[model samples]
Target: MILLLSLSFKNTPQKIREYFAFGDEEKKRLLLALCNEEPIDEAAILVTCNRTEIYISTHIENTNTLISLILKNCEDIIGMDIEHVRDYILCYTKRGAVSHLYKVSAGLDSMLIGEDQILGQVKDTIEFARECNTAHLYLNTLFRDAVTQAKKIKTETLISKSGVSTATLALRVAKDELSGFEGKKLLIIGASGKIGNIVLKNALSYDFSHIYVTKRSHNIDMSPNVRDRISIIEYNDRYQYIKDADVIISATSGPHFTLTKEHIKDNWDTESKKIFVDLAVPCDIDERIGSLDGASYYNMDDMKKYAVENNEKKKLSIEKANEMVKEGVEKFLKWELFQENWKVFSDATKSLEKEIARIGEKKTLEHLFYKIRDNGSLEALQSLIDTLSN
Candidate 1:
């Protein structure tokens, strides 16, 4: 059986974090241990801020053993009673697992519909499992196919156009608030990350004259085209640049607030009203920062509102994408079933051919003896036997 077990933030975000809070080395060690356990053929784990899922490929007879091993590993890592969280775990088998992965890759099961980062997260998790030698043939094929299908959907459908993503909505809000970003200084906190990088790309397409990016590290190198127009600053020096900027977009996965009320209180200049977009899930900017005298803030939930309102127009496209996903999953299942049956059919055919050869040999010997004993023509007897067999 192919099993997928997930504990998502939808029900227990805090608890999920506790299990994945360890460093990479520790996580790898734990994964190796889990893979070593009995009845676990293949094990791949995906741990993010919103979800923690384990995908396992094993025999149906070992289902109980696999589940118990997972529970034991979770208990060992979390050091707490996990029975309460078990109820929220979503489990899938075989075709259900395939369907769930397709839905997840297509963003249908995301917390925010049409979010684009989940696909990369899925790929990264799969790659990590491969690196650890914990992935089996089944999972490797399934994940590769899931990635291909996701790219196909993205290219063929309009589900990812316009307000298809929270990052795009954040950019739209920035443009709307700043009135086209012409000749403005945009301070982008956490610009080295995924959403931040996307926002920077969108901002560059606009009329912004100066783009300032800040992160925990100071190792960023500017491109030749925008070298003169762009500046890289350390995280600590963000306040120095943000005070003079006309717009600010913060998207960081840091545990705590990267932009606190105190930071905004001291650096915010009333002469220019700064538009801040927080695309981080936990949010980089504090909510109270919006209540400041001249500061405007938008969190992921707030950004999603704009996407939700505009998505109504693309209802048909979304429905079409859904249908495409359904058709794709059905085809995959049919092909998988055919593959399983083809082996059985081939084996049965070989067995039947061997039995027919044995019977034909016995009958040919009997016919030869009869022809020799009857002193008749061998050709006539062989022809008679051939006709009877036919």
Candidate 2:
């Protein structure tokens, strides 16, 4: 059976969700361990700023053990009982699991509905699992089907017509606050992240006076088109450059705040206008910074309010997308049933081939045609011939 454990901004508070945020290395390690030590046959984990979903195929009858194993592993990150963890996560099995994945890939389950980034993220997670050899036929087929349907939904519906996300919204807000990007100095902390990179690339479209980016541990790889436009700054020196930036955005996976009130006090000019956007789960900017004069602060909660409004606007498209997801789920379930019976088909085909060899192909065909002619229609004979040829 296919199983899914979803912990997202929809159900989990930022305090609890932050503990489940796994870095790339952690994800790889967890994938390896799940396949190696647990009863899980296949595993793929999707980690984003808003959700951490674990998809797995397993034959374990009692799923509680597997669920407990996962929560136990996170004890070092956050000490929570199984009951407490259960309060935040939603688990799905079989058909429900398949449907959930379709909605997720189609971006219907996202905080920002119809955001384009999620489909790519879903694709990347399955690809990573394939690379680790943790995903086999079951998960590979399921994810591929989900991705295909997601692309179809995007093409057929007006779900993503607005093309809005926290990244785009942050840029829009920055542009509005600063009049325009033409003369503004932009500083992006945690530029290596998914949303942060989106913000960086989107900001590059406009003509900023100068753009600065900082990374904590991961390397920020800039493409040829953007290399000349951005200046790489050390993460520790972020506060030093605060005085020069008109817009500051931070999106990181870490639990700690990147911009604390104390850190900004020395560098912040009280009279200068500065816009701060925090796109992280646990939040990268200090809430106290909003109290500072001439500082505009926006966090995930602020982003969510905008997302709700965006979702409201796309209600019709969302309903259409949900119907598509339902159809995709039914199709996937049918395919899954076929896969379950595939070995039986293979064995039957092998047996027929052996029988045909024993009787000689010509003789077998003649006998089958004679029998069909006597008892069945010409169409039955033709069907038998086609089946044999196959």
Candidate 3:
């Protein structure tokens, strides 16, 4: 059985964050611990800002036991009762699991449909699993097929080209709100993540004069190409620049709010108009902060609404993507059936060959006697025997 277990922002995004807040080394340690406790064959974990999922390949027959094992592994990572999340968990087997993975890789399952970051995140997760020697043959083939299908869909369908993600849309909205970003000081919070990085890249593509990035760690160096246009700052000093900035974008993996009313109250006097785009799943900005004077906030759900509206124009492309998914599923099923049939045919052919050889040996001694008794007419006798065997 193949299982894809996900705990995301569905019921509570905080729970997902609490469970996966660890760094790469710690995550690897946790994975090893889980493997030790469970009957997992091949497993890969993908923990991101919005979701934490474990894709495992196993032969466990009891679904209840599998679910219990997963809960046990995650017991120490989350604050809530595992039973509370049990109802929301989704399970897939065989072809359904394959289809689900393909959809996820293609971003059809994303909150923001056609979001471009998921593909790379999926690739990274698969690569990490391979590096750790956790992925077996089944999962390796499954992930490789998913990645290939995703790329094909992206190139063949217009969904990715027609609809830009929330990050890029946020940049566009910022540009429009700030009037082409002329002489604007842009401040970006949580700059190391997928959405934050895309926002920074999109912002840089425009004419923004100055861009400042704030992250939890200050040890990492900024890219050389954008170092002139961007500056990195400590996470604690983020609010200081928020006050002076014309535009702000926040994409963090925190459980609670990163920007509160108290943080922005003091900054209201310095800026006439401030646009805050919160791309985080649970939202980094306090909802009430938008009520403050001279402040505007847009969260992920709002951006998703915009994306859905824009997707209407590209209905044909969506249809094409759906068709591609169907074709892929059909091809996989056909090949799988063919392999099963081929194995059956091979076994039957070997058995038939053994029976024919045994019969041939029995007839060899009889042939000489028949030839001697029938005045050396061995060719006619051989033909008769061959006909009877057939």
Top-TM-score structure, candidate number: 2
In candidate 1, which residue pairs get closer than 3 Å at backbone N, Cα or C atoms, i.e. clash? none
lDDT tens digits, residues 1-390, model 3?
667777655444453345554556755765665666557777878766657777877767676777788777666655346676666666776678778788788877665566788899899988988888778676787788888888899988777785577688888777766678878889889888767877877788777789999877654346788789888888888878877788889988676888899776765754388888887755688878778777778775455555666667667877788778777766665555565489787986686567567777557556545655588567866766777799
Residue 307 displacement in candidate 2 (angstroms): 1.1
Clashing residue pairs found in predicted model 3: none
Candidate 2 residues lying further than 4 Å off, grouped into runs, are 76-83, 173-184, 204-210, 215-232, 253-256, 343-390
Per-residue lDDT over 23-137 for candidate 1, one digit per residue giving the tens place of the 0 to 100 score: 4465577678787886777877876545677888775555666777888887787677777667777877787888788877876666556567788878987898899998867
How high is the lDDT of residue 362 in model 1?
70
**lDDT of candidates 1 onward, in order:** 0.73, 0.85, 0.73
Best-fitting candidate, scored by lDDT: 2
TM-score of 3: 0.76
Ranking by TM-score: 2, 3, 1
* Candidate 2: clashing pairs of residues: none
TM-score of each: 0.74, 0.79, 0.76
Residue-level error in angstroms, candidate 3, position 168:
0.8
